[model samples]
Target: MGQQKTKKIEKEEPIKEEVKKPAEKIEEKKPEVKPAAKPKKAKAPRVRGQKWTAAKEKIGQKDYVIEEAIELAKSTNNAKFDASVEVHINFQLAKKSKEPIRGMVKLPHGTGKKLNVAIADDKLIEEITKTKKTPFDVLLAKTEDLAKLTKIAKILGPKGLMPSEKSGTLTADPKKTLEELNKGKISYKTDQFGILHQILGKISWDDKKLVENYQTMLSV
Candidate 1:
């Protein structure tokens, strides 16, 4: 056995606990939003012609009956050129009435104006293209030709020159229809606002003729 060595004892160190820091307060940010605005309607342009101004002045604020309205419309003829007399009727519709009021009247004396007529047959399409200006006031087309006229609907619709079956302007025999139209066969319809507007006759027409025409329409 070798000589005995003295045994050394080492003490273990004590573990220290880490101190916890208080949690910091943070503020959340929110996004700002704005509401969209509504669009405004544009006002109709005022009439600038002097004669038209005079015509407006002739029209009274109060409503006029059929006879009196015809007289007023005649008096309002201040145009340098011959002006057609027009009657605008406002109706107090019943709350329950949803159907539109529509009818046609053939003036005995005629409207005293010649309507430029256009036959919308395939054979006549070439004739339409040749005209630089829209020379026709009334366009007559058969059911078969209506599809072809669709190409020019945008141009015709705005002018109220588009012939529709609803107006009885779209006929099977366009030639006969054209003759009747030329003889002052007027068609009218009430607008969305429940107002009816139509030409009575030319301002140059005799008062008796105007009255007769008005009475004929009223009877309808």
Candidate 2:
């Protein structure tokens, strides 16, 4: 018998397939935060002028008589122009009192101001509306013109020029009111701060005249 040649088949290894994997997700970086800044320092207060300081030194802590005060005011005045002599009176009224402190004063010598006066008539109202100009400082109205003034109340009211019975600007006789105004009949009232401010006259006026006006205003 011939030797049997058995063919042995080698076992082939299974083919290894290279499987692809999913990519990893990337993370985003956050922004950096900063601390708050400090506040700036405040500026120093203003310093008064040498002239003003010199003048201030003249006034004392003690209350001065009216005459001395007026003289001191005149002496302290550094202005070259003839400045007005102003008066300010503070009132200690009962807070509960509802009455308003207001009245008209006919100064012996007029308040150096030359007020442009106007009559609040139908024609004046039309002219003011047409021109869009309020050339007058004072407005006097008659009973007949009171109705016409309503058309321009928004115009005159805010300017403190509106005519009213309480203000003594509304009257039956316009002529009399004009004369009184020309004669320096000025109105005054306690301000919201409970102080009354008025001008006596120009400093150039005689001390005697200033004193008289001051006395008259004090009397009221």
The lDDT per prediction is 0.75, 0.85
Model 2, stretches more than 4 Å misplaced? 1-44, 96-99, 130-132
Q: Which candidate is the best by lDDT?
A: 2
Clashing pairs in 1: none
TM-score result, candidate 1: 0.61
- Specify the poorest-scoring 10-residue window by lDDT in model 1: 125-134
For model 1, the local distance difference test gives 0.75
Worst 10 residues of 2 by lDDT: 92-101
- Give the distance in Å from residue 3's predicted Cα in candidate 2 to where it truly belongs: 84
lDDT string for model 1 (1-220, tens) is 9999998888888888898999988877776677777778888887598877777777848877667877786676556887888766777567567666775568888887777788887656655555534677777888778888876677778787777887777889888887877787877787767778877788888888888887777765
Pairs in steric clash, model 2: none
